[model samples]
Target: MDKILEAVVMSSYPNNVKQGLVRRVIEAAKQPMDSEQCWSMLELSTKLYLLGDTKYKREIGKEVLEVYGHYHPEEFEEFFNVRFLLSLLQEGYGPLGKRSHYVLDYIQLGLQFVLESPSANSIFGLLRIEVLRKVCERPSPKQCAKISKLLIQHPQCIPVGKHQVLFCQQLIRCIRQFQCVSEGEEDIMEFLEQVNKVSGLLQRIWRTQTSVILPSLKELFTIISSTETRNDLMYLVFLVTNIFIAGAHPCLAEEQEAPSNALASVVQFVPLELMDGVIRNLTNDDSITDVQMMTAIGR
Candidate 1:
């Protein structure tokens, strides 16, 4: 019966009448609703997205999001359209008022779909990069933390390509812009852990696409420059130096000359003052071999 009503309203009613009905239904949805009533209203609200122009589209999208908040749909992609949600995230996030609160949830959903699909090498790759770039542009503390954790926990999930370099760059940008290493030991440790994963990922990228990874080294330097506290600064320099060393180390005999040149390129970006601390930290780390230290310092 509800589907029949939707078909009739969509096909028979004039635009103005349908608009009026949509407004009424949206207003009515603000009141308390049982599960069945909420489901019906949700369907109607989603359909209204197809009914009117931009004005009604925002209205309908907000209404559907409200329903989603109430129910927390298990199959989010199935319950609501991912592309439509991405459009709202791209354009309507600010205008949608409180409905924009779910931006993180939608971003995660969008990323998951793109990563799980077989064609991540194609348009989905671009889509993930765009979505990540958007988060970096206006990163909140929570969003920064979430994205960092995602990168740390699932670095393998990100498919390899130039997109991987872009993803790492933006993730580093997010950390540099929004994250701070607090005084607490746990906070500092977590920050280091995140940095470790980021640098490890970058080292891997550098090994595969040494040419493309140069731009990302700049982001790594920004993370060190943006460090607020002395402890954080030292730790960032140390970790970043290791990333440079790993990148500069020759894996094969043919690339021996290239390793020193690569390390020189990276060294040029390090702050002159921090060079002392980088050497100090590398010396302090008992795990670092004499050859690695020489490679890092002499080159």
Candidate 2:
């Protein structure tokens, strides 16, 4: 019985032949193998089949996932992490008729697994954030707004530190770009509020340091200058200036020094002429137009 099971596990046969052999082995066994033993055999068999033929791997992964799901939800991660799924995604498998739905479902299931596992939640969150960023490449206003809402709703789910700050900055840039293309002022305001809320959360988490906060602020200022809408650009400038002032306020009572360096970083990204223009605007003595803003950046 052990020899037969091993033979079946190691077999490199066509799908029909493999299925027939597996069925025959199951039927001939005097006693049923326990779940773990059965699953182990199945995993080995599936891997063998996948190795024999790359084209059949997705089918094999689907069958393996189904069997694993019957045994335990925890197996979802293992099954979904199969190299086939990643390969399929990289090879643009989604647009291939029925196969695309399978790929999409697998990706969604993988995300759901991540969301449900406490230990894996942050990993999953970062994965989702990356997916969202990819989706933003050519997204509609509606899609961008939806992604922004997801980020805002689960800011704390993202692990703290430089990566989280970088992700948030990317999200903010996406939202600002979406706003620029669509002229969505209300959406932009809502995104800003979300950023402020998340910044507050970071402050609570990383007291006495603006390490996370500074990157986000610099990105926000960059986006404001990048937006071509005259009114929106000026509004964002005003908003950021106010935020900077608030950061510097003595009455704020924070343990850390204000992030003066963050402001300098923002200024560095702005072209020298733009820096001059911004200073002029702050003094309320400049007549810088939108074209001048673009030209100031040598665009």
Candidate 3:
């Protein structure tokens, strides 16, 4: 590891560069090594990335990905430290309207590799979530939404709880960015329907983490309520109401407080008729006791 680091440091010298050492560093990085050696190669990769030369950066990125793939998925957690990889992947967010195409491509490449690999274990899923979370910081909204949908649909990929809530927040952000212009109306409505289908999953997520997911839920309310067509609005109403009902279940009484707060946030967007329907639906459900019904009505 020291030898690798020393070679990298020496290659950093001015015009009197050690091309021999640089070649050797790259060669050594390609071979399987202990964690320490992987760490050193990663540091070298970061330096290459910082140079901002497209060729060098892409080569380094590919090399790193290949190196990662060498480790078996079941043992991946023991071999590579996720924090170190995350640190190396970071690129400062560019100004608004500017995109980090290079960084995004590298991340997507890694994500694709993970997704296509034979293993759908929680570890790969966790890493994918981390990578996706970074993308959320400066997202290409539509692309992010597509990736989120893929991840959500992947069986046994994303672990529940905090990761799910975090992903949900980003998914909401992506949805909120749609302009709803007529030119893109079909695509926009399709995207909204896809989101609606996932409401049960989102509802379960909300039931467990109501407080953490409240803001995103409220944002979703605003997005749905702002739909240009009444038909679109009515369709979205089902999604939001389904999510709320999950938390309102009698078994989840202990989880109801924060969702009630979220209900308050929903009032601003919900039409009177929609509210009446939701209330009616709740009242008709035999599973909800009178106490639970009145409590929901009061909210």
Candidate 4:
């Protein structure tokens, strides 16, 4: 680990030359390493993945997909390095497609490896944060869901609650980029699945930090429950129910009309004090019904 860190963070050459972590990562990623060494470099790259651009960072290796390194230039390059490490695995039984599939499997495995690191609280935050950012960018739906769920479950590993929220937001944004029927059953179900993924995340983040989580939640939950075509009332019922069940604040910027009796029934059991900070956070949310205000006030 120290040797890998030295190669990445310490100057590998004399006179404190321009070469450092970025240079070393690119060099290491450009060529395949032995299995043991390759795995080490892959983990090192994951550690470095969450970093911002250093003063002299280089681009990723050519074999990696453009999207992996395109997010923020050098910081995301380690995603490429992870892929390169997977490429080094000596294939013994798989066809070309299966090999590619194994690479994805290994990358996912490597991410899990780092997330479980004992030092994650001290140093893995940025890396985990970056990996989530990349995972959100273009991973398949199941991969995105799986990784996001792991992230939500390991809030302690993330350390920074805001970063955890960022992961949720980015993943939601990426999911939105694909076409789903606006507030249709399928759309609602998919969004709720992600809601389930982040249920623990919100519990860990929302109550104490309403101010930090509200903005992203507004835009994200709005997209989930009240898309452009969401003209029905029942959908709002399901959406608010999911929010409350997740212990998240019900913040719907698009619920222009007062919620129907159906929606009110969904959230009736939730205590008002639990929701006060959330209501305060949504000062601009005129969409909140008078019933909601009274319900919280009555408590």
Best by lDDT: 1
Which pairs clash in model 2?
none
**TM-score of candidate 3 on Cα atoms, chains taken together:** 0.39
Estimate, for each residue in 1-299, the C-alpha lDDT of model 2 and write its tens digit. 43565565456776677677655654543244455555564455444333434544445444544544444455444544545444544453433432233434454434444455553554455445454444436343344434334444444344445665665565455434332222266654544443344334334433433455445544554544443433322233443465455432111212122211122213222334345554554345354456545533431
Please write out the lDDT profile of model 3 over residues 179-259, one tens digit for every residue: 322236566555444334333344444555555455554455444433232222223334345544543211111221122
Q: TM-scores of all models?
A: 0.38, 0.37, 0.39, 0.39
Candidate 2 wrong stretches, greater than 4 Å: 1-75, 82-92, 96-109, 114-160, 179-211, 226-299
Question: What ranking emerges by lDDT with the best candidate at the front?
Answer: 1, 3, 2, 4
Candidate no. 1 TM-score: 0.38
What is the number of residue pairs that collide in model 1? 0
Off by over 4 Å in 4: 1-126, 135-140, 153-162, 174-195, 198-200, 207-211, 221-227, 230-235, 238-274, 280-299
Worst ten in a row by lDDT for model 1: 250-259
Off by over 4 Å in 1: 1-80, 91-102, 106-126, 135-138, 148-163, 178-212, 218-299
Q: Residue 117 lDDT in model 1? A: 41
Query: In candidate 4, what are the lDDT values of residues 188-256, reduced to their tens digit?
Result: 566445434434444445555655455555544455344244333334445455545554323232343
Colliding pairs, model 3? none
Per residue, candidate 1 scores C-alpha lDDT tens digits across 1-299 of 34543553556667676767655655555556566665665556544443334564545555555644444443333444545555655665434432243454444433444444444344344445544665557554354445444544445445457666676577555544334325566664554454444445445545555554445754554344332322222233343455445542211113211211112223334346555665565468676566544433332
Question: Relative to the unseen true structure, what is the C-alpha lDDT of residue 222 in candidate 2, on a scale of 0 to 100?
Answer: 50
Candidate 3: Cα lDDT at 81: 41
